[model samples]
Target: MNRSVVKRVVIGKPLKTRELGDQKINKLKALAILSSDALSSVAYGTEQILIVLAGIGFLAYWYSIPIAVGILVLLTALILSYRQIIYAYPKGGGAYIVSKKNLGENAGLIAGGSLLVDYILTVAVSISAGTDAITSAFPGLHGYNVPIACLLVLFITILNLRGITESASVLAYPVYLFVLALIILLGKGLWDVLNGQVPESLHTPIGTAVPGISLFLLLKAFSSGCSALTGVEAISNAVPSFKEPSAKNAVRTLTMMGIILAVLFSGITFLAFWYGISPKAEETVVSQIASTVFGRNFFYYFIQVTTALILVLAANTGFAAFPLLAVNLATDKYMPRIFTIRGDRLGYSNGIVTLGAASILLIILFEGHTEMLIPLYAVGVFIPFTLSQSGMIRKWAKEKPSGWQLKLSVNLVGALITFTVLIILFTTKFPQVWPVFVFLPIIVIIFHKINAHYNDVANQLRIEGAYRREKLKGNIVILPVAGITKVVENSLAYAETVGDTVIAVYVAFDRESEKKMEEKWNAYRPDIRLVTLHSQYRSLIRPLRRFIDVIEEKGEEHRNSVTVIVPQFITKKSWHNILHNQSSLLLKAHLLYRRNVIVTTVPYHLKK
Candidate 1:
């Protein structure tokens, strides 16, 4: 099938430009679509903390609740700070915009690069964690986790390419289901704890601590639990995707997402502690808790299914934010301009596909193990958190708007706290996360190079003073033909109209073909000059390029502009293209860079 037909089938028919406004969603649907990442982290975020603390002993797992509380405090700070961002910069560039305007270009690039890396990792990590849930429930499917994660990435990529509203509608139900499922699980678990019916911890007992809970271990656990805050900034980054009064609607959505996430994360961590759940090789803490509360029945299975779905859909948050972030960089010339172009469905299709591909690569590289991937996760995100909060402080200081002191204080505390967290996360996650620091600078350097190249092109292309025109003394058109055929005849006919001098040049590997071509050209009598060149090496491109070079050198004296028309036959079937030599294509590629030479392709379609 053709591209248009396939696209229509995949993403549905293309919507008109005017229909873009109709695609805007309300705060209700926005909560699910944009907040899935932060909300779903409750699945693994609590587990991550327990994983770290469990290293010391079973008693160290008690630290999970306190660390979760700390993460919630940070979440509250971030929500308030980003709400200010939504109102202040409604166009939604997120940290990149805030840093660029308030900090500097270099800081902005740093923030953008950090966020880009984090967003890509979000897809890989979320999908991997989701697949973990799957394997936890069905041990028979344990070995296929990487493949499962990759397929989930591809599915979400296609859904987002369908456009924002379409993806929101399809993904929103699962988020609600996940929330409802967890609420039911949490209620039952809490009731058991309160009524003195709490069962003993099901986890295998770890012996007494080798080294008791040190401040280092607590910081490590806290940093891991901070994954719960990954998607908090997504709503602020996507303010434009909401309905009228976009910023207000976006802030409302942010508030709702924050409250729901706080409740779910804290509840999950508390239940896991009470049940003495620990990360297992084959099961997640959430899965263990759910199985304990709901048993091996429908409710238990329901929670697992929704948990997997939400974790996979958490990549949707990255999908929503990464494209917009990329567009901001592209607009600033730090990225390729193609990322700025919206696809037929009005989504940043290039950015979406790029994220999906990167995520798949990461999943394959890490073998879809969430524990291995988690260490590399929080640093990229925290870098942005620190920079964005710092940038907001500067904004408040400079503008000094009404209630600027309160805004500045809010941002100031956020900056100091996030900066401290960033340091702790880095120190705790060193060596495993050292690669992120190395790559962060490389990404920033690449952005600088891209921007510099675009600026140089703009300078060269700028028509500053006046338009310059020079009258051409002569016009010469070179038509490369392989043999005497209808395709060549049609090309020669058009070539005659474009220039006063048209030369039909043929490259012949042997004398027989040359002699035959001369006779046929003489008989056809198209009234254009015929030049036949022999190549003993059987190289079509080399012979044709030499001929064009000679023509350009000779034409220089007469101020003549030269054009090369390559005649290529288009077969009915695309597969038939492989049967042909594609010599015309090669000739065009070779001649396109010659000064004062124009290359064109004239295609003659085949009927059968």
Candidate 2:
């Protein structure tokens, strides 16, 4: 099949530029697509807390309630701060744009690089967690988690490549399903407890109670649970993806997402405490809660299935936000310009593909183990949270818009809280997260290099004055050939039209072949001059390159320009072309950097 046909079938036909407006989604779909990450984090967030608390003893596990409350308060602060961001910078670069405009370019790059890394981890961690949910329900799939997580990444990447509206339509249901399933589980679990119908498993002894946990350990647990706040900034980053009145729509969606996330996170944590659930290697806290509340019946499976779907689909948030962030960086010349280009389906295909590939690499490296990837998660997330909030504080202070002091106070609280979380995460997660510290600076350096290169190229290409043309004294066309054939004849015919002088040069392995070529060329009645060069080591490119240098040196004497016409045979199939020697391509690449030399190809198509 033709490539275009394959692309059309895979991602649907290309949309007109005008259809970009049509691609904007309503708040409902935006909530599902953008909030999936924040919402799905509830699956693992409580477990992280429980695991930390469980480390000391089951008694410490109850500390999760206060920690959960702390996270909720922080989430509320972030929600309000990002809401202001959405309205203030409606074009929607989120942390990157806000940091750049208010804090400085370096701050922006750090914020951008941190978010980029976080988005990649979001996909990896979410998909791996999702796969964990799967294995929790069906133990048979445990060993296959890596492949499963990778396939989920690929599937979501394709969905986003199909376009925002289309992806939303497909992914929205599972998010809502997950929310509904969790609600049901919470409701039924609460009712059972209130009615004194608790499961027998709840009475089982966990361990001897330990009285104390260090402040550092408690902070570690708090930092781990902070994963719940991972995707809270995504709505602000993607305000433009909403329908008209995009900022308002994005703010509303952010509010809805905050409410849902708070309720689900708090409910799950509560049920885990009430049901005496702890994180098990084979099962998640959510899975334990569901099995306890609904038993291993239909409702139990429904909760597990929906949880798995939402966790996997939660990667959709990264898919939606990373590309838009990349476009912002590209617009500012910090990233490659290709990132600014939209795909046939009105999505940033390059960024989506890049994110998917990176996520797959991470999933494979961690072997789809969510716990291993989790330690690397919170640091990248909170760095941007702190920076974005800090940037917002600066913006409000400088501009002092209407109600600026209140906005400043809100963002100040957000910044201080997130920065405190960042310090805790760094101190606690140093062993696993140190690599992020190393990688963050490297990424920022790369951004600087790319921006510098673009700046240099723009300076070189910018035209400052009226056009001035240089007159060439002469034009010389040199045609390199392997043998005399129709391709050579056709190429020579065109070379004759281009310049008065056309030299057909051939590289021969032996004297006999050189004599035969010269005799054959004379017999063919070709008017062009044929220069025969012998290669002692049978190196074709070296000898040809030397001859081109000789010709270029002579041309310089006459102020002449040199053009090398390479004759290439076009095979009927692309695969067949690969079977033949690509010396012409190598030659063109070799001469591409010469200032006065031009290279061109004359292709003769094969019927076979």
Candidate 3:
């Protein structure tokens, strides 16, 4: 089997165009596929907030309560706003789509560029955080963590290449298992909290302050907790990926995801407060709380295992959305044409591999350190969040259909809150996140270049008025032959059908060879004129190029074009191809760029 066959076997068979509709997912799988990023963020969201609040003494827990509450409030508003977006554009109106429709092309492009960058960062940060969880559980394996993260990326990449349904099937169990473990942990812990079995240290206020619990610090802590809301919009962006009644299924899934995320976020925040768990360099806050609730037993390890599974698999969200978003960008001519091509499994195969490769680079560059990478994650996501919600407000104002006031109020609140978060994330993390700024301009410029190229191509190929099918105007076939072998005879025979006139050209290096060729032509009488040229420089390409250029100079006179037929000798054994000279291959390469020259390769296969 060849490379393509092997690829199909590895990635799954090529799905037909109509088979795409069959690939739409049910709600269970859609939740697992699209909600992984948001759900998994629960594993680290509280930890991010605690990192900032650690400075304010044991009051870190005190500060965390309000931040978690704020995040929940924002989560509700964003979900309500996005539900409107899902219904408004049931065919998946992501930020780029919404902004482009309501705002303008530049706004749309900016949103697209931001979302693209965010998708890449999502994979990298999720994998890195997941790997950190593993090392926190077993400190001895810490040195090899980056390589482990890269391998995990490759694993998820293959799963995604198998198509969304297959990936959802593989991932659904772990995501559901994680939710089960989390709720159980939360239920038991909450039951203990209410029953007064909680540790006394939680309420005992140790007034040790790490100095600055200022307003800036509180805002930063709130912004940090907002990371949990990162992947919430993915559901609204990918509404069409659901089964029939797609909008209803999608909105339901989005609501379910928000509820689950809110429950987990608040549960963990409450647990962290009761348990007085602070961020540890070696262990995560979730791991710490799990130990407090379950204590180094089978259930504790179960929580840890499932957390790692969901976190690493969180890249699945990027896998699902990136390809879909890439196809959208390609359709709009903002990305390369290749992104619009489907793979064997009918997933956005190219986009899958692209996200994987980019994440791997990030994992290596940052050494798989989760804390270092987390700061860069929020800005890209929030830009789209702000723009998309603001666009919805604009759209509602202009359209003002039924219930526009309610919709406008929800989106306005979401827009203001997200814009504030975006600014806070930028001002606080700009030192570490300068890369995001640098990367955005490059991405936006690339979008412009792609749009420009597509426009130029469209203008060149546009057929206005009526397309006149002109007859083949004045054609000539030129056969470049080495000797009078079977290959030459066959090439000459095929060249006869090329046009009205055929010329068999030969390059003679010496007088003896020229005389021998003329004598053979005379004896055989192939009934074709032979134009022989002398070669001073043993380079075969130079002579063929000169001949084609000479023909090109005969514009509109001796026929319009020259078609060069190059015969390729295919060996029975692939290894034997190196045994023959590649003169005709080189000849075709020389003639290919000439203005009215056409090059055709005719394979002449040898039978043993």
Window of ten residues with lowest summed lDDT in model 3: 464-473
Deviation of model 1 at 537, angstroms = 49
Sort by lDDT, best first: 2, 1, 3
lDDT of every model, 2 decimals? 0.83, 0.85, 0.81
Q: Over the stretch 263-366, how does candidate 1's per-residue lDDT look in tens digits?
A: 99999988888787878967778889999898999999899899999988999999999999998999998988768767768788889999999999988887
Residue 554 in model 3: lDDT = 78
Cα RMSD (Å) between model 3 and the true structure? 14.0
Query: lDDT (0-100) at residue 105 of candidate 3?
Result: 88
Q: Model 1: residues >4 Å from true position, as ranges?
A: 199-211, 468-608
Better of 1 and 2 by lDDT: 2
lDDT of 1: 0.83
List where candidate 3 sits over 4 angstroms from the true fold: 199-201, 204-212, 465-608
lDDT of 3: 0.81
